[model samples]
Target: MKQFIQGIKDGGAIGIGYLSVSFTFGLAAVSSGLQWWEALLVSMMNLTSAGQFAGITIMAAAGTYIEMALSQFVINLRYALMSISLSQKVDKDFRAGRKMLLGFAVTDEIFAVAMSREGEVSSQYFAGLAVLPYLGWTGGTLAGAVCGNILPKTVTDALGLAIYGMFIAIIVPAMKKDSRILKITLLAVAFSFIVYYLPGLRNISSGFAVIICAVAASAIGAVCFPMEEEQEGA
Candidate 1:
């Protein structure tokens, strides 16, 4: 019980950061012709920042259902990978039903926090960590949908920086710990720029570009940094 409470406290701190960005998501939804409740429902179900943004953008642009579905499929495929990694950290006694319920809460931020745990993670602790952020994300979207029009354009522009900041926060520590991550980061940036400029690839859909980048990067990483026998055991 104590550990569970601690997880909620930890999650609440992280949730505060999400509030600002979700506000923009809400605003965009309303501006893009979605009802506030629909916007809120999207946030609640997805619980992912980039995926939701891409999905809404495609929807607003009158993209085909196939395009929207494919975009989300590509963007969110990372979560599937993250879940596989996290499976090793869960308590051995955790039931299938519990895992299914908790699986839906696996966002990048939550996975990062959970992976950093020092030992096997209890379901209670995981659930506690999920609660506040889940609520904050849902509530923040609603708030933004309702109040977006009143916010200054400059403030909204500045709020865009938050996503970049969040990415940096996630990347810096990993880069500091592993030269492989640094190398991969550089490679990804170079590859992205190349794709952005090269005429054939530049015109491709963003969803396809993301799939290419992820697969190429992961392949390179696997070749360069194959897991050791000991790591396989863990």
Candidate 2:
């Protein structure tokens, strides 16, 4: 019970951070022609800022279902990896079905908080970690969607970068601690730019472009920056 309480406390910061970013997403969605309720629904169902942004961009552009599905898949591939890593941190006796449900809420912030916990994590703790962020994200989206055009352009533009700020806060500290992480991060950036600007590739659909960049970057990291497992007793 103490641990579960701690989990909710830990998630407080994440919830606050998500509120602004997801609010921008709601505004963007409506600006892209989604009904206000539709924007809130997307936030509630998807709970992924990047994937939702890409999917909505495609929808606004009249992209196909294949494009939406594939784009979301490519963007959310990291969550799958995050979920697998989190499963290893959970208590052995935790129920499988419960863990599967927890996996649904495994955003980057939630995964980081859960993994940083001092001991084996309980499903209850994980649930506490996920709930507030879910409310903040969904509620913020509803607010933004309702206020879509009312917010000034400059304010919305600034809010749109909140997610990038959140990512930087996560990545910068990790990169400072590990050179390998820095290298992989730089490689992903360079690889993405190439995909975006390069000839022929520039013409690729958004979904395929994301898939190609993500897969290529990950493959490069796996081969060039593989982690060496620590020995049982160094």
Question: What is the TM-score of each predicted model, taking all chains together?
Answer: 0.71, 0.77
Off by over 4 Å in 2: 1-3, 151-203, 228-234
Candidate 1 segments whose C-alpha is farther than 4 A from its true place: 149-234
Against the true structure, candidate 2 reaches a TM-score of 0.77
Task: Give the RMSD in angstroms, all C-alphas superposed, for model 2.
Answer: 4.3
Highest TM-score among the candidates is held by which one? 2
Candidate 1 global TM-score: 0.71
